[model samples]
Target chain A: MLNIVILGAGNVATHLFKAFETSESAKVIQVYNHRLESLSFFKNKTEVCNNINNLKDADLYLICLKDDVIEDYASQLKYKNTMIAHTSGSFPLLQNIEQSGVFYPLQSFSKFAELDYKNIPFCLESNTKSGIQLLKKLAKEVSKQVFEIDSKQRQTLHLAAVFVNNFSNHLYTIAEDICKKEDIPFDILKALILETANKIQTQSPKLAQTGPAVRQDFKTIDRHLSQISDEQIRRIYQLFTNSIIKKYE
Target chain B: MLNIVILGAGNVATHLFKAFETSESAKVIQVYNHRLESLSFFKNKTEVCNNINNLKDADLYLICLKDDVIEDYASQLKYKNTMIAHTSGSFPLLQNIEQSGVFYPLQSFSKFAELDYKNIPFCLESNTKSGIQLLKKLAKEVSKQVFEIDSKQRQTLHLAAVFVNNFSNHLYTIAEDICKKEDIPFDILKALILETANKIQTQSPKLAQTGPAVRQDFKTIDRHLSQISDEQIRRIYQLFTNSIIKKYE
Candidate 1:
């Protein structure tokens, strides 16, 4: 079994901890957080450390902190030649460290939801060839797809992910808001949501686009806008519609 | 089998034809299109007609024309009180014809892609009680969820669908464009896309949202924007990021 130590207790950290716990080939040797309360959940299976000095020696160290604090955390941990990894998409592999990499799971994680990692793509990157191979082997235990992506590619993927996932969910928020304001049942729009996602899986977004905006049907667009009283939603509808029309043409 | 005559040979018409063909309770008896060439696909199973005068008698006449031409086509149909219906989300029950209603499948249709209607939601509305019952029965054959939604509610749902599906998809298109320009593979973002959808299914979109934009991380946002060379994409990213930040705050 691979010896692993997870740092931080945020969503990504919690998810990684639980996922590794379930994996046959990996075992959490230790858990570390700046605060003792954050490491409380992993108290039974592994040793929890609040003090930086008490950080145990492990084969691999996975840093699951926010992007801004990754560098600081890496500098504080003085383990030489240890295979260190961060789970942030935007941050690059640490250059100052002798052996460092990224283990970015390209998915939205929540504490409540049970994540199925079978289809979840793991983007792995390391400075050393053996480190990459080891990371790839660990990734293979959970995920069907794994890529040895550099920091630049991961950044681009993260940006694209923001557009497809984050921005898309925001649009769903806008839709839910509109439905609530109009006193329409939100369930009425559920199937359409699933269909839209399925369509993208088969066809390109350019070919799959529909609505008054794509047709340039100003009358229908005006009618739709007139129904909504929210200024932000109206502006969003107009701006996005215009953007789509411009992009496709 | 319930004999059904479909009017118009557009995307909706073709989709309905394929759906009804698989439906055990219903069979398409005839198809009417302004141009006879469009009716070629349904020739074996349906009696194709270009002229309304040649329209055959059927249990139901489904008008599947565009919103602009629906009224015009509805006015020309010789058949009346034969469970006539229009496939539109915005159009009201036709008061001009007896037993007229709507059979709106609340999803986008594409000719190239095969649609699985088992989970697709269908919104049914009719002027008469019997018409509503028949439409509900017909819808139940193809979908698990069927609701009696009036034109007002459907219009609201349609508007919301535009936000959730159309606008959300435009965001995906933008992200894809950005990724393409940056030489990033679009599949890298698929895991995020699937997870985002799954997240919204359980939690509110507001709670499920995550990104540099939502967190108002100007440092990363500026960094991402600087990397993009396309003027249009940069503008879109900036505008959307600003909107998301504003919404969250």
Candidate 2:
């Protein structure tokens, strides 16, 4: 079994700790965080440490900290043979570390939310070939989907993720806001939202595309624009409509 | 059992026909369309006609035509006691028709796509109380979720649906485009897409929102913006970033 040491106690870190704990091939030996309060979740469950010097010698040191502190935290880690891998999408692979890699899971994680780990795509990158094999093995323990992605490809994936997850979710928030303003239950639109998301699983997004914008239904577009009073939202509606029209039309 | 005559053999009409076909309380006696070719699907199962003048007598005359032609199609229909309800998101209830109402299902429909009819929200509007009761009965037969929404409220719901379904799907398309250009397998992003969509089912969109924009991570945002070459997509990135930041920060 591969021994793992997790750094940080954020959403990704907590989820990873649980995932590793359940895997027969891998086990989380210790967890470290700067704030003693944040380490309470891992307390009594594993060897928790507040200082970087107290980190246990393990097969892999999975750094699940924020993007800003990853480099600093990794720089401070003094390891002999243990590979250091970060669970960040945008952050690059650490250069100074002797055995550095990336173990980015391309999924949003909330501490309380239940996840189907098998479906998550783990993007792995490493400075050495053996490091990648180790990362791949650990990733395969919890997930069926795994890819050996470089820093550039992973960064691109991160940007694309912003569009699919962040921007699309903001669109849902906009819909919720519109429903609230009109005294309409936001629940009514939930089915449609789920259906739209499900459609692309089987069909290509290009072929699955539908709406007044794609149809170039000026009448409906005019009506919708007239209804929106918010200047920013109206502009967003127009921008998205134009973007879709430019591509399809 | 209530007999219904469905006009227009499009996506909405076909889905509704199938939904009602399974219901013991309602039966579609006839389907009408301007083109004889479109009515081929409903030929053997039920009475079908190309000519609008040949519309059979039924308890409800459901006009499932395009928004622009709904009024003209309803005007040609000569009904005695049958209530007239048009299945549309944007089109309002027919003003001049004696027994007019809206039977709009606030869900996107494709003729070939399979749907979960029970989850679909059917929004009903009517001129007469009995017409509403009839619609409520028919709607409840196929779907558990039904609401008595007026034309104004239905219009608002339609607008919200566009934002959530249409706009969000467009964002997915954009992400797909981004992934394709970068030589990254688009399949990798699918898990993240499904997870983001699933989160809102239990959590509010506002609280479920995450990413650099919400986190105000300008360094990562700049890196993403620099990587994107498309002018419109970059602008969209900036616009959405600002919008999200404005809301959360």
Candidate 3:
């Protein structure tokens, strides 16, 4: 079994620790966090450590910290020859370490839901060939899809994800707000959410776009804008609708 | 069985006609379109006619025309007491017609793919009691979720849907374009898309929102925006990111 130690006890850390513990080929040797409360979740399966210096020797050290704290954590680690990796989409593979790479599971993790890593795609990158092979093997234990991506490519994918997922969810929130204000049931809008996402799976989103904005029906657009009392929502509507029309034309 | 005559032969017309044909209680008696080519799809199933005057007797007449053509088609139809309805999210229930309502299946339809309307929500609205009953029955035949929404409410929902479905899909298109330009596989972005949608279903999107813009991490935002060469995409990124920050504050 491959010995593993997880640092940082945030959402990503918790998820990775749990996934490793459940995998038959992997064993969690230790878990570390600055706060004792954060490490409580891994009490039974692995040795939990509050001090970074207490980090035990393991075959692999996975740094699942926040993007801002990653460099600091890397600088403080005393372990050497341990295959070190980070679970960040934006952070580059650490070149200073002998065996460094990335183990980013490209999916959102929440403490409540049990993530089926089999469906989640893991983007693996490393500075050395051996590191890549080791990380790839570990990734296959959890995910069906594995990709070897460079830092530049991973960063591009991260930016694109923000537009597709984060911004898209915000749009749903805007729609929910509008429905609430007008006393329309929000469930009426739920059916379209899945359908919209499914459409782009088969065809380019440009071909799938519909509504008055694409049709460039200014009269209808004006009428719809007038119905919203919130100035921010109206502004968003006008700006996004204008953007879509301009892009298509 | 309820006799239904479907007017227009666009995506909505074809989808609705096919869905209605599968219903045990409903049978399409006629299909009408001003263009002969549009009626070719219904040639085998119903009495396809290019002339509006050729409309036969039916319990309901559904005007599945485009939003702009809805008014024109309503004016041309001579039928009265035949319960006329239009399948549009933005268009209000026809006030000019003697028996009018809306049978808007609140999901995007494409001719190339088969959509299961069983889970798709249908928003039903009508001026008369008999019209409402007819629409409710028809909606029940295909969809499990049905809402009695008025024209004013539907107008708000449609606008909201534009933000959530149409505009959001446009954002996805923009992201895909950026990925293509950078030589990054769009598949890497799919996990983000699915997770983002899943996040909104559990929590308010405002709480789930994350990115360089929301966090005020100008360093990363600047880096991402600088890499994007398209003026239109950069403008959209700026507008949406600004809107998100403004909403949170």
Candidate 4:
């Protein structure tokens, strides 16, 4: 059995706390967050602490806080010998603490969305071999995918994730805005969005590329730009179109 | 059964022909293309002809040609009242032909990909009410989703589809490139990509948005931007990050 303490109450923290509670091999000994309201969700299930100084002794201290505060929290922690890990994608395995590791799950978490922990890939790294082994066992308890990624590779993965999730969703927002201005239902484009995301699963995204950009149809490209009056969006369209043309042509 | 003839054997034409063949109410009697190789897919399944002048009598003639050539194809067709319609999103309802309409299915179609016709939204419009009614019946035979969209709305939908499908896929390609360059397996981000796409189905794209940009985390954004060395991709990241911050914050 593994003893765990989650230090944060944000989306990732809450979701991880819920996931840990259900694991027969793991127990959430405590949950610590700065705000009392944030800690309310884990109050009944485990020992809740609003202060980091009051963090109880546990086998692992999983810091799910912001990147800026991670080093501060780890350095401030009074507990010794207990393994300290962060769930950050960009942050390195060790910063201010002597004993540190990473248990980064490469998936976006929302408070309302229910994620199956078994499906999410857990990217793990550590300052020591024993720390990594402990993280691997705990991660294997929840996720079938356990990757021993170094800090540099994890950082690259984080950057790539931003492009896939953030930039892709931004494109959807633009499409939604365009639909609203034209009094068109956005639901009509939902099938296209789903198909676009699903295509890359089996095929390479480079091969799956399509549209006026890939075809280099200048007339359609100009017409599409004319339709969008927003300068930012038009430039985005042009830039992406140029990139696609450069890639294929 | 409705007798349908498909002109032009491109990806769209091939997929639509296969879909219509599965329907008991619709029979695709002829497939026409300027190039003999393009019509080869429909050779054994239907009457394949390289000459448009050899077009046979049919209840509906679908000009599944490219947008630039749809007008020319419609004008050259020998049929007069056979309810001519083009399978184009941006193309208007009327062309040089007397009886023309739009049979735009707002979904990305690939020749090799298996598409569920029932889930795809079919947008229909015509010059006459009877023409639209005929299209609605034909569309209903295969698809559960049917929308009576006008020329302007279809144009807008096409533009939106560009953003959602074309632009979204471009971002995925970029991410794949980043992953390939970093020696990281692209499968790591597959779960995140699937989650981002699935979240927008139940929630608005606006609500589904997340990342350093959406959160307005400048430090993380700068860190991510630093990780990317490609000037074009860096600009893309910065531009998209700015857009997200502008939209949300």
How does each model score on TM-score?
Answer: 0.94, 0.98, 0.95, 0.96
Backbone clash total for model 4 is: 0
lDDT (Cα atoms) of all candidates against the true structure: 0.83, 0.90, 0.82, 0.87
Clashing pairs in 3: none
lDDT of 4 by residue, A118-154 (tens): 8899999998888999999888888888899999999
Best by DockQ: 2
**Which of 1 and 3 is ahead in lDDT?**
1
Per-residue CA lDDT of model 2 for B1-249, tens digit only, reads 899999989999999999998999899999988899988889999999988777788899999988988888777774555689999988888887778888988888988899999999999999999989999999999998999898888888998888988888888888888988879988998888888889998889999999999989889999999999999999999999999999996
Candidate 3 chain B has its poorest 10 consecutive residues by lDDT at B73-82
RMSD to the hidden true structure, all candidates: 2.0, 1.0, 1.9, 1.6
lDDT (tens digit, per residue) of candidate 1 on A120-165: 8899999999899889988888788788888988888887887788
Task: Please provide, for model 4 over B1-249, each residue's C-alpha lDDT reduced to its tens digit, 9 standing for 90 to 100.
Answer: 899988988888988887787788899999888899877778898889988778898889999988888888887773556789999998777665567789998888888999998889999999888899989999998899899999888888888888888888888889999988978999988888888888898889998888888778888888888888888888889889888899986
- Candidate 4 chain B: worst-modelled 10 consecutive residues by lDDT: B73-82
Q: Rank the candidates by TM-score, best first.
A: 2, 4, 3, 1
Least well predicted 10-residue stretch by lDDT in candidate 4 chain A: A73-82
DockQ measured for candidate 1: 0.70
Q: Is the docking of candidate 2 incorrect, acceptable, medium or high quality?
A: high
Candidate 1 similarity to native, TM-score:
0.94
